[model samples]
Target: MLFLTRRRKVQREGIDYEQIDKEWDWDHFLILQAFVGATVFFLFPSLLHGLPLWDLRGLMVAMVVHVGVSEPLFYWAHRLFHKGYLFEHYHSLHHSSKVLQCFTAGFATPLEHLGMCGVMAAPILGATLMGFGSLGLVYGYILFFDFMRCMGHCNVEVFSSRLFESLPFLRYIVYTPSYHSLHHMEQDSNFCLFMPLFDALWGTLNNKSWQLQKDVSSGKNDQVPDFVFLAHVVDVSFSAHSPFLFRSYSSMPYTFKLILLPLWPCIFIVMLVMWAWSKTFLVSFYKIRGLLHQTWVVPRYGFQYFLPFAKDGINDQIELAILRADKMGIKVLSLAALNKNEALNGGGTLFVNKHPNLKVRVVHGNTLTAAVILNEIPANVKEVFMTGATSKLGRAIALYLCRKKIRVMMLTLSTERFLKIQREAAPEHQEYLVQVTKYQAAQNCKTWIVGKWLTPREQRWAPPGTHFHQFVVPPILSFRRDCTYGRLAAMRLPKDVQGLSVCEYTLDRGVVHACHAGGVVHSLEGWTHHEVGAIDVDRIDVVWRAALKNGLKPV
Candidate 1:
């Protein structure tokens, strides 16, 4: 029934029909239960002994009496369920979906549902006992109650300010969609559903509810994307394989390599089949709620399928997520680590070429990451060591250091790339050197920033006092027998930032990686419409502001 309303839907920010479809599975159960309950109560009612139908005046009185009594009863009952054990066992079920829908209002455990039913029925039952109730009043209350509940549960705000503007006092008596939405989001406020009267009286009203109600009512986020998805894939083979397997696979006996080569096609076919069949749909929905109110939906593709054998699968998956994000109206999207590498190098080029209509601007987010890393580097340190000199991030950092006239040691496997970077450097800064070496060569440096490609074992080589910075997911692992190493991490911005919009992830502990953080920064700045690829040093302050706002203390 609610799905029909979605056809000519209220325009709100972050309404993903795909996400709605995924959640609709649970609505069937709720609908079926409601149908059974209605059938039992009305069609074959054993409880309504004699239908003592009442007139219009009696119905009006019953409505007034119902609100007066039900408010306090429902308030206390709701509060009690939120207490310790009851919350963990029952109330949490209702709180699970922070992004509510009309059908979701009735989506609760049988016990909780029964409790609500009893609370609503109490006033009507009392009126019946006093011989003042009618079948008309009972049915009227049921329909009206269901309508109000749906309005409250619907994520879209339904109330206009005109009525409230005329009568400001109505806010105390009438709760809006945002009133109930805040309860789902904060869990501690807006406890009274019938009216804010009880919640206000008991000091349980959320401080931000009124402001949020005003914001949503004005359609603040109507133009912006409802959610932004950060898409990436894991290296399953790298995770699953042993170090020996990697070495052996790279340089095995010529005959053995020949034997394995024949199976390559078979492996590819199997991987393709698995990827085709796999459900590359919605992975998770994140409800970000601190500084701003919004939702981020992450839809995953089976990108890790052809791992160790081939990397072609990654491109397909990135494309899949990109198309999906576009459909979800995610104006700004960032590719995570390997996904970025694949997309920018070739797949990304092909995608933009093929789909000119796609409005989503893809960003690698390397600009802010480099800025965060540079800002974090100690001023006292004399030299900086960096691996993956050929990577976009490495190149940006290397160029930045060259311009600053600081000593930097850029390490890479390609001798040609090293020479090209060194040759391009200013003649005055010969100290900005490039070398073809591994992690071992950077031992003497006090500052170490490595790419994501470095293994856990290789990372442990950083000297004792060295402040190691890694801009990678799963972060740099520490295998030190004794926990005594100086490690640095990206930091979150203060709650109050001067001269900058406070845009940040509500969760992730303010600890978001540079790539995803970049997109978030762009979104906050209202620059989702523009394309951002390699950020320049002069304009790195955008990333700085975002990092400061979203960054947490390094772990």
Candidate 2:
């Protein structure tokens, strides 16, 4: 944000969002600014009782300094500024001219001005009464952040135009004239009264942390629809809902990195640790492959995947999935939910028949533990095709596989019966399920009834309504009230799917997914799936082995 704000042209949602807000009386603002600064500075040292408050709890004090004081003050005061009557009294001036010019900064209502004073009011008075020197970090931070505010609010862009064009780092050192420009023009634009972190975190920030990316991306609109706006509120209340419609954490701001780091090393360390862990799988790919004494296999639904190992011709669905995958060039580990001791290379047509190149290994079905899934995924996985598991199980498996750094296809069956069959077999997949039975009718799902429903017996393959062919591209749920089971049996969901508990599992690269209906090859090549596709038994045994032996597979 600071970077773009340094520019000369007018832009909305630029770092200058504050510039667009109601104008504060220059005298009042300056007075308040100086008064607040002087008061905090002189009185703050009194809180230490002639001792330092930093000794006992540095972090706790920093918390009290910023969160305990500044955060709540800004939130409530900003709320006050938005209130109708009070806003009209003092706040209106700040917002009077929505399309603010560069000079419009430092503009605030007088009452709003009092809130600024409140910054040091507590610390100074409290420190004086407590018979200690003003030692709290809140005081120091208030001084530092507030001074920046005054400087940032200055209508003047501090550097020469030529200097800014050449040296980008100057943008970081100062909040340029352009930074506050977005605040005044756009209603929902900049609201970070004195701090930039909130705006960055809430996706409301108007400028870039570094000046470099400004021209390419820093312009901000800040307007949101009623639904998106409402969702933001709900997201704060629910962690799962925080899916990051606009996630800045993945890409944080400089204030968080530079300012907060001094006082928050743990946070910095955590970020570093997370960084190392993410690339760990990538860096150690060959090492993990060398430890590849055994390969892991995850069996799909319809395959009735069982222990006696390959004892079941693999489930029909499983074979079908494999056949479909073979055509698409996807290779994957089929984990059996029922067996914990099983190895990835164990039992199956590939293991016993033994294709010279195609090596089959079995793996513990639970190899995808919650914790492992939480962290990293193996980099070797090319594509993942999963079908017929409980939503929870699917998620667990997906989560596990994803952490291994592998992307999963997350094959889904729209019908409850299909899901149930998958559930009975694997019983533990996670993701979404739209009970087609509840939408249509129980008889709609019955093969016999479906057969009868078709106009001509010869065309009974998929029938009309229940055909899986229609949703191959994107699954859209259609529910009929009368056809639906009672609410008890009805799958609980929002009135509209957009409102439902939606969680998207990202498919990883190199993994081809062959779903039940078809298009498995399309989704595979489209996404660059890595697993070699093997069709007929011979293809699975011979072709796949040859590639595996040659250290290259069609995937």
Candidate 3:
């Protein structure tokens, strides 16, 4: 069945189908190891004991023990391997293969393999300890474990929606191929090997597991609907310094190396071609389907064209994103990070003026960003140290916080702009502690609202215990022991959002900044005008509710 399905190239849920070729060798080696190890273990252990054949009753007990005892042991052991340096050193080897096949089922380091083997054998081991062990039951259990492992890793959806729809309760207990595939995608979820009892009880189930299962089981294949596209460019020139890029490059075969080694020069040539073409090339990046929504997203720049040094091309990239959105009948096109800066004169006013005929509404998403940031701030946070205080986002946050009677230590590079804002403050804010400074003068303040991109040096210099409300992309703070950081994101979307799936620009908690969330909100609301600069604070509720309706927190 597996071979027949593979030959037909049947649809695989949540897999990069192309990655199968890349992972083939590693997965093949592990399959060989598992068979060899199982053979040796089976032969050697039985040679000492001779055969203790099972009756029907003994076989039934062993089966129950495997599910009741062996599964829980494996679950905890699997979760233990996920902890800190253990995952980095040992278990991460298995995760290196993002695309799973039956061959990839047992692809773990020797240590992990041994741990899993020990866990899986606990049922037979217990039966022996209790003096009723049978060789037939032992062999049966071993086959069962290997079969289930292979089934979980197979790029096939075996469980149909009718089974789940008719017996909805089974959805909680059953761990299908799609369920385990979700674990491969989201490393922190769906930890149980045979059943999802532990995962559901412990709250480690992947958010998308049920949905992916339902979508695939219901016969929803890879075809994308006519949907709005969205994403930011990963300027390969700038990402050349990224460790992730270097690691990925080094792991590739020599043939891949030959191609990727000259990526920069190739990108330059591609950019010139694109420039000559003088039209946006809409490249379908990826497609996603949820129970309620399906979308096809595209990014708007060649690697070389979006490099920071290539400032002349930034506006063209912006025009391409909007134009492509319009071309695709995208209701709303949200500008991300640098794209937002280059468009609308950093406030969205310029884009509205330059492209009045555009059907797609352009949004900066500042209002929802301010709202999400402020929502995460604790009520006891009476003081906040803010950077980028002169920018539109910074001023809006300052005004909002000051209205709440919070002392704000505003920091900007310019003292002139600082004093001007203070002078222009509301009459009641005249007596408030809205101090202005040109340096990192605020200390002992636990709350920080960083609205500007900071250098690595400045990021390191930020005070300890400062809970940062970070708005900058490629976040400034490291995962520090002393600091707590809240990345700006859209969270807990409302159900009314028809099948929205935000791949990037979100924290695990589902929080997105108002900027991107604002675009999603506009798309949901059918609003097609420019929502630039400072968004009114009152609009936060509208954005928040939109996110909730799309599935953030249930109504």
Candidate 4:
């Protein structure tokens, strides 16, 4: 719920999400300890004795205690915390985080947390004193309290004003995220815990709370992104690492999780449902130098790409996403992962050809990709072995290296394709391009560029000390431990990237796939041409220089 709400933030003001990510440790521990202590105290008979497991009377009593005692106490205590000494020494710690995430509810100084713990205990103690306490009531009240705190601090408006309009008294009974957000921003109003009735009675409610809630819930503040990266899932398990599912997990490079293994069947079922009913949806968003950039998922998996029958369906999804971006006046839409597969859509050529008048630039982003891979090869090296030699990236690498007077042993069974690429090179350098059918033909070459996956037996052909550079998806297995393998071509994003809390695939923080960065450069340069179809080999150096000028460090 928190993740869904955050995607539709009520307050669009900029906040350092990275800073907030770093500030969660101590407060999280403190809150966990408090909850555990409360549970232990209520369960074992330390102060208030453990009662029956379930009782209707205990449930009713818990509500009364909360409304009559807990709510008022918290309201007054919250207001007090905003005043002179309390505000400066303790409460200000919580208020320091101007942006409210769900965890923000528990992010407070120990003293403020202590007071909150006390307020929570009031309801359980009161129920016990009234001879109606039960184990169910204690657990129920505590869980409900925690839920309300998280909801208020979640920073997104989930409640509709229509609910309040239908039940007018509910406004005084329950406070919304917008209402709590105003208290954080304004600092002197809307000082309620879970109910606005206390604030109403004390004449401290913010005047804009209701209107702001209505406006946000109705989506009046949503902004159109300037650039969108059209991406797809890599596999079933890794799909759980999406930013909307788990912030901490998505913030780091992904690895197979043993814990997630048990959930594979469930996740696979979700994939089926998505294949059946899902449309393209926003996965994450961030800003770079005031430009709104978003990542949208195509709702298909990597394995699906290899299934010939699923090809058209996948392209249909990508086409829909492109048209949608164009309709929204988006400037650029870059295809990522299999969304730009050459065999699938000819590296986004189908859409460009079908809709030639598209105002939105459809970019395959392989230009920078070719540049990154090409630059990774040592400039002094004279000869290199290339696999998947006839593919888009392979052809470009071969031609570029041939022009540099470097020998490129192109591995392919097709003589026709090799000759076509060979002819594209300058006549003076055409001799540098050599065609080889067997992997053993390049056994003497130390520089191996792999575009296709190599099996253990096939990998044995590479002599010792050979370095394998790759642009392959699900990068080839490191079968030969003696050789060093390069990761998929990638680059680090600029230092000023904002609200980027999720990592791109297996890349580290602040780093993205080279193609992803390519799209970013295209948008930043305001290039009006569509970077679709075949990669312009001539523009490889241009994109590389532009990336460097824009602060994109090669990784």
- Scored by TM-score, the top model is 4
State the TM-score for model 1: 0.51
Error of 1 at 37 (Å): 20
TM-scores for every candidate against the unseen true structure: 0.51, 0.27, 0.50, 0.92
Candidate 3 displacement at residue 19 in angstroms: 14
List ranges where model 3 is wrong by over 4 Å. Answer: 1-229, 235-309, 342-344, 419-425, 430-435, 455-463, 492-502, 505-514, 553-555
lDDT digits (tens) for residues 1-555 of candidate 2: 121332333432212112211232344566776776667557754444355664334434444555456655675567557668876787777666544333344566667767766754554444445444345554564566556665554433443545656875554334444455456555454565555555655676665433523432333321111110000011111211111221122111111233333435553454345323321110000011212111112222212222345444333323333343333233333322222212222323343244333322211212112222222223443433333223333434444443344444443445553445334322243332222322222222311111011223222322244322111112222332222111100011111112111211111122211120011111211322222222121122332233234332221
Candidate 4: which pairs clash?
none
Candidate 4 positional error at 504, Å: 1.4
Error of 2 at 50 (Å): 4.0
Model 1, which residues run further than 4 Å from truth?
Answer: 1-227, 233-274, 277-313, 320-330, 342-350, 353-358, 436-438, 453-460, 481-508, 528-538, 545-555
* lDDT agreement with native, every candidate: 0.59, 0.34, 0.61, 0.85
Query: Per-residue lDDT tens digits of candidate 4, residues 437-537?
Result: 99999888899999988888988988999999998888999888899999999999899888777788888888899989999999999999999877889
- Model 3 Cα shift for residue 18 (angstroms): 17
Q: What is every candidate's alpha-carbon RMSD to the true fold?
A: 14.4, 24.3, 16.0, 2.7
Candidates 3 and 4 compared: the better one by lDDT is 4
On lDDT, the stronger of 1 and 2 is 1
| lDDT tens digits by residue: candidate 3, 140-216 | 77787788888888766887767977998887776898888878777888999788877888999788877787777
Alpha carbon deviation, residue 154, candidate 4 (Å): 2.3
Candidate 4 residue 441 C-alpha distance from true site, Å: 1.0
User: Positional deviation of 272 in candidate 2, in angstroms?
Assistant: 49
lDDT tens readout by residue for model 1, 60-126: 6666766777788888889998999999998887787546667567766777777777766766666
